[model samples]
Target chain A: MWTFLVTEIMFFGGMFMAYIAYRHAYPLAFAAASQKLNIILGAINTTVLICSSMTMAMAVHSAALGKKNLLILFLIATLLLGGVFLGIKGVEYHDKWVHHEVPGPNFEFEGADAQHAALYFSLYFGLTGLHASHMIIGAVILIILIVKASKNQFSAHWYTPVEMFGLYWHFVDIVWIFLFPLLYLIDPRK
Target chain B: MSDHIVPVRVYWSVFITLLVMTVVTTSIAYIDLGPFNLLVAMTIAVFKATLVVLFFMHIKYSTNLTKAIVISGFVFLLVMVFFTMCDLLTRNITAPGR
Candidate 1:
């Protein structure tokens, strides 16, 4: 499982490299393009994800202490927070659609360096889209864990699921931690 | 980790640290620092991410093998990105003759 996650990190690392190159090479373009994204929404999403991370930590704590009910409550809290993050993300993506910021077809930016602007949107969609996919997977994993939890499949003695899930949840949170600034910060107009 | 629950205080501290990091990053974004801007922003982000991995993800309590694997993964990732970007960095603008 750890190896598999490392592989995923490598995948994202490739894109992050591309992001750095483009952002540095065309700083103005990337900034102008990036500024078009809704920072407010991004900030809010960051808050939501941070909250989710807290809940996930609590869930792991509950499992460690054999507090099944607390574990379930915190897990549900984490899940709801995951949903809230996705919900805000949806709104941002919708705004992009109306503004034609979703690259690959009729995307345009009214800023310095059109190509880099396009590149920004491309990265925006690409990174966030991948993150969103992970979130869905995380949610599914949680639902399963929740059900198993009811059956007492997890306890202080056997709770690898809780720990593993916490790891994944924290990972997702870390990704968004990076994403918040990369997508929302810096305006070329400045 | 053997059926021992980490305290609630740990969770609260993690939450507060994350929140503070978020604020710092956002504030830094509004300031202009030339090329250093991206560097500083990304550096702070890396710190925040590390915090999540260490505390929230319990990497601190994880086995040595797990830590080794994770670190190696990031090491290789950095290598891949760095080497690839080396070529990509020196494009048409900085030719020897030009």
Candidate 2:
């Protein structure tokens, strides 16, 4: 799990460097570009992921105590929270698509640095796409855990699966921690 | 066995605290701190990440080997990002852009 997170961070680290270079050279453009991202949805997803993180912890907590029912409840909560995050992400992506904000041939920008807006889109898609993939992996893991948990597999002595899954989930949350700033709070003109 | 296995209150408390840190960092990112913006943002991220790894993942109570392995990995990662930034940030990309 630590190795996996290191790779993810390195991946984001590369993009973060690009962000730094571009934002330094063209602060105005990056700022204008940043404002174009949907903060409302970003904030909503933040809340959603927070709820999911809480649920994941509770799931492990219940498992540590060997409470099957609460474990199941928290596991289900984790799954539902994952779905909500993805749903909100979908909405955010749709908004970008509608606005021609996504980097592609059809992209349009009216900002001072419209030509460099592609950089913002690049970072946006690259970071968030990778994050969403992680979220999917986490959801799949919880799905399997849910199946096993429902069958009374986990107990106080053997909750390693839940612990490992928490590691992965928390890593995902940390990715979002950096992502929110790079994507939404760029311009800060408001 | 006893009813208490994990400290539910402490675990949940740390998780929620991480959430709050995320919000606080994001909000602060909107203030335009010149170069400090990214610095502050990443610093806050590191803090939240630390909390999750230490508590949610139980690295604080992990084996010596586990802790060492995790810390070494983080050290290497920091080096990688650091060197990459050194290479990227020192380049001369003109305003109109090279």
Candidate 3:
């Protein structure tokens, strides 16, 4: 699990490097494009992700203590929170689509630096899309865990799956922890 | 492998700290601090990531080998970013005729 996580870090690390380089090249465009994002939705999603992480942690704790019912409950809570996050993300994506902010032929940005602003939106979609995909995978894994947990598969002596999945869930949360500030909170005063 | 079970209280504390830091970072973004705004935001983010890794991920209770593996992953990431930035930031100064 740790090995897999190391690879995941490197994978996301490459995109983060790209983000840093681009933002360095076009700070003004990045800031202007960032302001186009809805901060309220972003903040709420951040809160939801954090709450999910907490519930995921509790789910792991319940598994460790061999509390079968509590483990199932917390896992369901985590799953619901993940669903809410994806729902809000869908709303944000819809808003972007309506405004043609997606980085295809329909992309539009009313700014002097429209080209660089498009680049910003491209990275925005790339990063957040990758993160969202991970959450979707996580939600699938959570469903399986819930099924197994209901069968009393996890317990105090053997809860490795639950614990490992907890690591994955937390890693996803950590990605958003960085993404939130980078994508949505870029010099908002401008 | 022996497992360490973290108390519920610890998880709650870490969770609250992460939420509070999120709020703080978001609020700080609205206040222009020039270049320092990015620095401050990233600082808060790094702090929050550390909390998640150490507590929620149980790195704090893991074996020494696990600790080394995790830290090395991030260390290598930083190295990649650092060297790449070194090149990108100095391309103009190193070869102005390009």
All models, DockQ values? 0.65, 0.46, 0.85
Provide candidate 2's TM-score on chain A.
0.94
Pairs that collide in candidate 2 are none
Clashes of 1: 0
Which residue pairs in candidate 3 collide? none
Compose the digit string of candidate 3's lDDT tens values, residues B1-78.
337889999999998898899889988888889888889999999999999999999888889999999999999999
Tell me the tens digit of each residue's lDDT in model 1 across B41-64.
Answer: 788889888878777777777788
DockQ (model 1, Cα)? 0.65
Residues A1-190, model 2: lDDT tens digits = 6676667667777766676767777777777788777787887787788778878878888888789999999999999999999998998889999999988899899977787877778877887898899899888989999999989889889888887788789778877866776677665646
Better of 1 and 3 by TM-score: 3
- Candidate 1 RMSD to the correct structure: 2.2
> With candidate 3 superimposed using the best TM-score fit, by how many Å does residue A165's alpha carbon deviate from the native?
0.4
Q: Local error of candidate 2 at A190, Å?
A: 1.4
Leading candidate by DockQ: 3
**Tens digit of per-residue lDDT, candidate 1, span A1-190:** 6777788787777777778887878877887787787766787889899999999998988888889999999999999999998898898889988888777667877776777788888888889999999999999999998998888898778899888888888888887888887778765224
For model 2, the docking class works out as acceptable
Query: Which pairs of residues clash in candidate 1, taking residues 3 or more apart in a chain or in different chains?
Result: none
- Look at candidate 1 and tell me the lDDT of residue A174: 82
Per-residue error for B18 in candidate 2, Å, reads: 2.6
